[model samples]
Target: MKSFKHTIRALACAFTIAAVSTTAHAAELRLGSGFGDNHSSTRAMRDVFAAKVEELTAGRHTVSVFANSELGQAPEMVNQAQSGINFGVFVSSAFFNSQVPEIGVTNMPFIFSDRETAFKVFDGPFGEKMKPLFEAKGLVVLGFMELGFRNITNSVRPITQPEDLQGLKIRLQNNPVHIATFNLLGASPTSIDASEMFAALSQGVVDAQENPYAVINSFRLYDAKQKYVTDTGHFFDVIVFAVSKTALDAMTEEDREAVIEAGRLATLEQRSYAAADEATNLETVLSKGVELTRLTPEQREAFRTATAPVLDEVKSRLGAELVDEFLSAVDAAK
Candidate 1:
């Protein structure tokens, strides 16, 4: 315990040294996210997170937000937070695997059938277990926001079954678990940063990509000619709302409470918005002349079967006991 507190204090010193405040007000906490300005996550950051922080702190502290990866790509922004240049970030849990592999427990293919079970498992002991892993690496887990279930999109043709994915180049987040799932289904998966995805699709750098409807619509991928979508819902992704332990410790106790409260409120609001907006986003995409394919239970089962080995793969990487514990937690929740 003494060593842990020492670690926290050392981190706070590093952050304080990086950004020295001169005026009566301390440097505004910079919060960054990879989502675009129009995305719900970005909106939550602006209206709920930033606003609530100021409200709770009575204007003594403030939060400044940069949307659309304005701070940098996922890895770059993550490094900045660790270095104490930023206070908090909203980034995909997949990106943090390089730092904390246990995060992949949530990335297993077809693991979640619906939002209720997903939230039950994540908001319970599984979430508590994951937080300390992050703290050990200099990040404080503020909360987890829904990125929602990911779907597949391409210019070629509608994918009605798992066989249709064979040999096509698909763009996926830089997650090994996702890559393994797609590989088993016989697709060539490439890792592309979200910011560069539009160009890659327009130039035919990759033939298809998978993301939630929010991403396809908000990022305007249809404009890049990705007009066909299959609602694969392969993985239920989460956005980790985390603060750098360095920056977190630099704040006054009251200020820290404000940040935590803001994160909690924003997370709840964001989840509600995310759940309700998927239909609206799908409507917007259909209005753009994008072809949508909704899979049947049997068809989705084919996918579930093909990607089943991904569980074993993840267990190999993260450990069988831990992975089984996560699975058992999901079962208990169900």
Candidate 2:
């Protein structure tokens, strides 16, 4: 009977220890983003990723998102994640070009024909190959979310031809390839963070900006006196979902796997939502009294041909071998 009593006591102690360990392992991560809370990217992290992480980990993990530059702009948030001050951030792929110029290869102007082709490339081996680039920068790329095709918006005038952009002061993301492309197209490009863009346009600090229709509608860029919007679709932008290597490394094996899987599923759903809403989002912009211009094939070709030199410039900046491999992968996807 004494042996039986001792065995019961030992089992109770073991149960107490296990419960304590589980409580100790529970983690609450903070996610940062440059987009508003209502944006698709933010919604994905909140509704999908956060929910899945809690469910997958059985309440052992949770993610709290800070949207709309609440943490900081893209570069600042990226730095925070790199330094382990923030757990993760969802930012445009263009922003990553500053750290890994090789990423610029993916931002080549007019390279992708449509959303389908773009999605194919990014969801394939080419996308897998780019993961290490972030890892090298102390970031673990979780998945790629869609920002969709970027269109040009200006307060100056309608951009119908390549020549129309001449003398226009355009605000571009701090991306060398983007600046080069705009310069080749005859616009004076100024690198500006997204948070500053609305005020820049409103105050005439910059006369033009380019972003996806969803972005234009969400940020209400039209209210900043943007009268003209052209479906230039010059570049397809991606929102990279990344976690700090520090945070990821600290996770248990099961928790890490859960995080990755949750990220992947969230990205897939976000892309589908963005793609499905493209037309409706464009309509929303038009309803706000903004003049929408659709480019004819010849007009689009003019912009494409004018900016073709940018490809060579990018190749020179971001190694020929890497660019070639990316192009080959894109071709294979085609």
Candidate 3:
């Protein structure tokens, strides 16, 4: 009888411990971002997501961030999330374009005239129509994170004309559209992953690369042997906060809303912060002793004209009708 009583008490203690642990871990959302935590956008996301999750869940749910490839490379992390290996990743259109070829429409070179046009397309129909497509692939896109516009940075001579890029070896994200676009512009495109780009640029594996000023500043590209910076603004980038559909489905309604709401707020705040920093970031690059090769408005137009073939190439990947729909939506947006 004593033995039976002792066994009963032990089982009760085990059950009690398990119950407490389960409750404690019941609603955690793990997020990953490509940029280091020090970057403004990454830091904004971490702070806003965590604070909003706690507020909306009344402290029952929470969020934590893994920044600077702590989870994995941006593209690989999204794949893992889609496969249900992890929670989610913050990734750019470059990451999504390869997965959903239909998404390549967003990668149309020189599509947006400015950040305002870019925002219109994203916040309007073009962005809304994409959520269902993402859901079909076991990923949940919470909100669009603006990656600003891409411009060329090179160790070679200044690129004031399209002919200047001839035979130049440029590092491009491992995306079909990006590679095709650069190839169309007469550069030898090397498909390098973002995590490896710094080393690739430093070692002369690539002569130039393109990214927004924020990235150039955040990654300290000035230290990577780059010489000239151009304001081609050739393409705008859009990153989505993607979560695993499996994980999202498992969350309680309240917890799920909390997570999504947190992401939406983060997007708004980050976009504002990014807009205000572009000039400052460009100035910082110059202050670091990197030479600026300002693209004349006419030269920018020529680069755009030269890359026009990329739109048709992008259409072929994303489907012609989808491309038309995306462009139409862009026109219709307020």
Q: What is the C-alpha lDDT profile of model 2 across 235-294, one tens digit per residue?
A: 999998888998899889999999999999999989988888788889999999999899
TM-score winner between 1 and 3, please give it. Answer: 3
> Which 10 residues in a row give candidate 2 its minimum summed lDDT?
21-30
Tens digit per residue, CA lDDT, model 1, 1-334:
9999999999999888765554233558788878988788888888898899989988877889898889999888877777777877888999888888899889998988898899898799988999999999899988889899999999888999888999998998899999999999999999999989999999999989999999999989898889799999999999998889987787789888888889999999999989999999989988899999999999999999989989889888889999999999989889
Q: What TM value does model 3 have?
A: 0.94
Residues 1-334 of candidate 3: C-alpha lDDT, one tens digit per residue: 9999999999999999999997776666677767866666687677787799889889887777888888878778888889877778886777876566677777878778877888888888778888888998999888888788998999988888889999999998778888888888899999887788899999999999999998898888889888888788888887777889998898889788888888899988888888888889898988998888778788888988998888778666667889889988777763
Instruction: After the best TM-score superposition of candidate 3, give how far the Cα of residue 120 lies from its true spot, in angstroms.
Output: 1.7
Q: Relative to the true structure, how large is the alpha-carbon lDDT of every model?
A: 0.89, 0.89, 0.83
Each model's TM-score?
0.92, 0.92, 0.94
Ranking by lDDT: 2, 1, 3
| Candidate 2, RMSD to the unseen true structure | 4.8
The lowest-lDDT stretch of 10 consecutive residues in candidate 3 is 25-34
